[model samples]
Target: MSNKAAVLVAGSWGTALASVLADKDMEVALWTRNVVQQEEINTKHRNERFLPGVDLSPRLAATTDLEAAVRGAKAVVMVTPSSAAREVARALKPFWHEDMLVVHATKGFEIESMKRISTVIAEELGCDEGRIVVLSGPSHAEEVVNRCPTTVVVASQIAAQAELAQDLFMNPYFRVYTNRDMVGVELAGALKNIIALGAGMSDGLGYGDNAKAALLTRGLAEITRVGVEMGANPLTFAGLAGIGDLVVTATSRHSRNWRAGFMLGEGKPLETVLSQMGMVVEGIRTTKAAHAISEKYQVQMPIAAQLYHVLFEGLDPRTAVEALMGRDRKTEMEVMSLETWEQWHT
Candidate 1:
């Protein structure tokens, strides 16, 4: 009921969301550890390193003191990259309380532990995981900051928690939908980045739309397979967080995963590609986690497996593509039959 909210970190997406809240007339305090970045945001209303040429809302303020940012806020939005999520949540513990709404927009698995971002945050906060809401969909920071029409979905095991996120962030240009399948929503958002990287790789290798289309189609199947095995509803894969997110992430030039994949396809070494990115390309890390998850679940994830070899085992991208083309054939329904759906959901 307080119009005050806090956003953790000032990355591209984090800054964009802060702007959204500020535009809606909320007092938004964004926390960042970098003193220079904090001054730039507060003084110039510009975050050139992240959102170039975009004017941040004047109502949005940046702070170097984490407690000052979080102490009185009614809501806290966690937008740190997946790698830093646990550490950030740990730091917020002293200032965080159950009365504050916890929502996260981060989109990746914890590569080392294969844990979802919300899980990591909940563990650190010592609260029920259901109290955390996940915000996800086919959104890019560049588009959202420009006030482009965008729709996103929020999920929580608890309906009221999901509604809390929906009410806080929804606006005319930014539409929010609610769903109860938190597991499906979180997994879909994270896994789709891996396919986007492959899509970029296909384009970088001079492949046509036909190849990309097939890749996207099969990639969704792979994502749904793993997600269902991990307690996600199969039908959730047909919704926004699933197909909608997959289509946008794999096709958009704004996708960090796609850009990194293109570089890898252009024959740059993984180390060089990462150095050139300057920002975290989440798909690279998600690929590693997906590899481990697929093995742990005993699910076949051909696209993710080939990508892992290329990324970590020094396999040529072309050879990886060739191996995929030569894999044993099976009916498309082998993994997606109506029976499969019934079995997964039941």
Candidate 2:
């Protein structure tokens, strides 16, 4: 297998991961259409627009050529925003090979299709869905590029593929774990952004830690509720991909979702917030898809529904909060997994 790796769409996360692979002394080719970004990365060893002030690795290269990017590479990491996942994968289709280890660090569903990132990639590449790997957890691109101590999970239905991804990306500054709960990992990764938005809005609204904590706690239950119904292992939500990701993205200054939510809480319009964010707030789109998903699965996602109204229905954030609180009093612990509760007793 070649020691070269390819990462599509050199956004902040893609650049950070490219540096990680290059730090492992593996040649990395980062693909992007932005001519200036490509040249900056190649000449100055900097991707200033996305990973400002962080010096990229010398072994990493950047290019606009999709074919050249994946050539002779053993692994390809798709890190484009969710909106572009299909288009980028489609472009790579003719170049994709069975031996290439396809991994996606992109989080969020294809809203129209409501499909997971791995599924979208597999469908576009005409490959076995089970073979693709999902890389997720709380690692932010800014912290990761600075080589902050970071950990993440790579999940696949095939244990061997998960292990292979773990080996390719892990290093002293970064740690990787493997799980077979691909569905749980992917769902957890995408859904947490909505909760993060809520958390950030709580802070922006001048609510204290108590409000934030309640939001995080209930938000997680809401995520797990939807996840288990979609065939994920409930335990996966308790691990790095679940509660771990939720906490970081909700609280961190680096989260685009949190920032967008904060702006919304400050009374900015959704369009204005998105324009100011200058990045894809995955949670916004994920919220839309999840609204449909909750309907499709006949699941009650109260928090998600409220978020949908605030984000799209133009309901005031405060009103949405009131709606959530004013709902008929209910039990705190609803059965999370739709599966047999008797399993717990067994």
Query: What's the TM-score of each model vs. the native?
Result: 0.98, 0.98
Residues forming the 10-long window of minimal summed lDDT in candidate 2:
337-346
Clash pairs detected, candidate 2: none
Model 2: how far is 111 from its true place, Å?
Answer: 0.4
Candidate 2 lDDT over residue span 1-346, tens digit each: 5999999979999999998999999999999998998999999999888888988888999999999999999999999899999999999899988899999998899999999999999999998888899999989999999999999999999999999999999999999999999999999999999999998888888888998999999988899888888888788899999999999999988999899999988999999998888888999999999999999998889888999999999999999999988999878888464353444346
lDDT of 1 by residue, 241-319 (tens): 9999999999988998999998888999999999988999989889999999999988899999999999999999999
lDDT of 1: 0.93
Off by over 4 Å in 2: 337-346
- lDDT of model 2 at residue 59? 95
* Candidate 2 TM-score, true structure as reference: 0.98
